[model samples]
Target: MRLSDKVVIVTGAGSGMGRAIAELFAKEGAKVVASDISEERINEVSTSIKEAGGEALGILANVAKESDVQQLIDRTVQAYGTVDILVNNAGIMDNFIPVGEVTHEHWERVLGVNLNGPMYASRAVLKIMLEKGKGVIINNASVGGLFGARGGAAYVASKHALIGLTKNTAAVYGSKGIRTNAIAPGGVNTAISGTITAPNQLGMEAIGRAGSAPMGEAQEIAYAALFLASDESSFVNGVVLTADGGWTAH
Candidate 1:
């Protein structure tokens, strides 16, 4: 067990990459906190982990909200003593709307969940992590953070900002035994596409120009995250681990 006796919090644990991370972390001997906005989905993931002889707790949390993020940390400490890892995995996709066509509502909603959520969660957990002088923070960023046409304006911007945040956190806290890093995953089969209700032709055309890459699985990313969250990555910090199967090699 790579994470034996560790306490981990994985937001958006209801499905896709988040669910995979929670389950895998549990199997690695961590007490998993599977958080999601949906109560039923979160409960299912938590129940699944326990049924597999792993320890897990399901908590409903909308990471976009500060109060919810605070409660999440408070509840985790109340249950598991302390948090050893925090996976900022909860995020949403924009509808491929470029800046020209993006409305304020769309921008705020995307930034709120994708950017503000991680910021809030990271801020709350830093206090706990700093006290212990040892902790890991993994941000599930996207290739959009690295390239321009991978997503809409808001989505790409939020992820780019997230990677920046990851580096800044790592630089400031690495000496304190805190490792903050990010994973930039390529296209993966996930429910996040459900958020793309309205696609913009210009944005779609821009993405088309970039060409397609092989799709990855949620578990594959979970493995990358596992490495980052474990002591094996002790010397790795403030880096963006790209798991895009050479999609951006060209």
Candidate 2:
């Protein structure tokens, strides 16, 4: 067990890659804190983990809200003593509309969740990690962060900003025993696509041309997270691990 006795917090653990990561971490002996906007979904993931003889705690939270994120950290500490890992995986997709077609509402919503959410969570967790003098943070970025046209203006902008955050966090805290990294996953089969509008469907289809690698499964990405969260990645920091199936190879 790579993460035996580690305390891990995985945001957006209600479904998709987040959920898979939570389950896998639990099996590897990490005490998992599964948080999501949906109470039912998070609870279900928590219940499954416990039933399988793993430790878990479910919390309902909107990562974009600082209050909710703070409370999440407080509760996790109260239950588990301290946080050892944080996976900022909770995120939303934009409608894939170009900047010219994007609305102010859409831009704010996407950035609030995709960018600000990670910042809020990282801020809350840093206090604990800093005091302990050791921790890990893994941000879920995307190929959209690496290039244009993979998603809408808002999504691309938000992800790119996230990569910046990851680097800054790593630089400022690496010597303090904290590590931060980002994962840029390409086309993983997940529920984020439901947010796509009809007009933007064409943009989604164009993803096929970017990579010959098959669309990734949630578990595939989860495995990547596992490595970053574990002791094996102790020497790795401030890096963006591209799990984009060769999308950027072009």
Stretches of candidate 1 off by over 4 Å are none
**Model 1, span 1-250: residue lDDT tens:** 9999999999999999999999999999999999999999998999999999999999999988999999999999999889999999999999889999899998999999999999999999999999998999999999999999999999999999999999999999999999999999998888888878978999999999998978989999999999999989989999999999888887
Instruction: Give the per-residue Cα lDDT of candidate 1 at 209.
Output: 93
Steric clashes per prediction: 0, 0
Off by over 4 Å in 2: 201-213
Pairs that collide in candidate 1 are: none
Clashes of 2: 0
- lDDT values for all models: 0.95, 0.91
Instruction: Report the C-alpha lDDT of model 2 over 189-233, residue by residue, as the tens digit.
Output: 987767675647665556545555458899999999999998898
Q: Give the distance in Å from residue 174's predicted Cα in candidate 1 to where it truly belongs.
A: 0.6
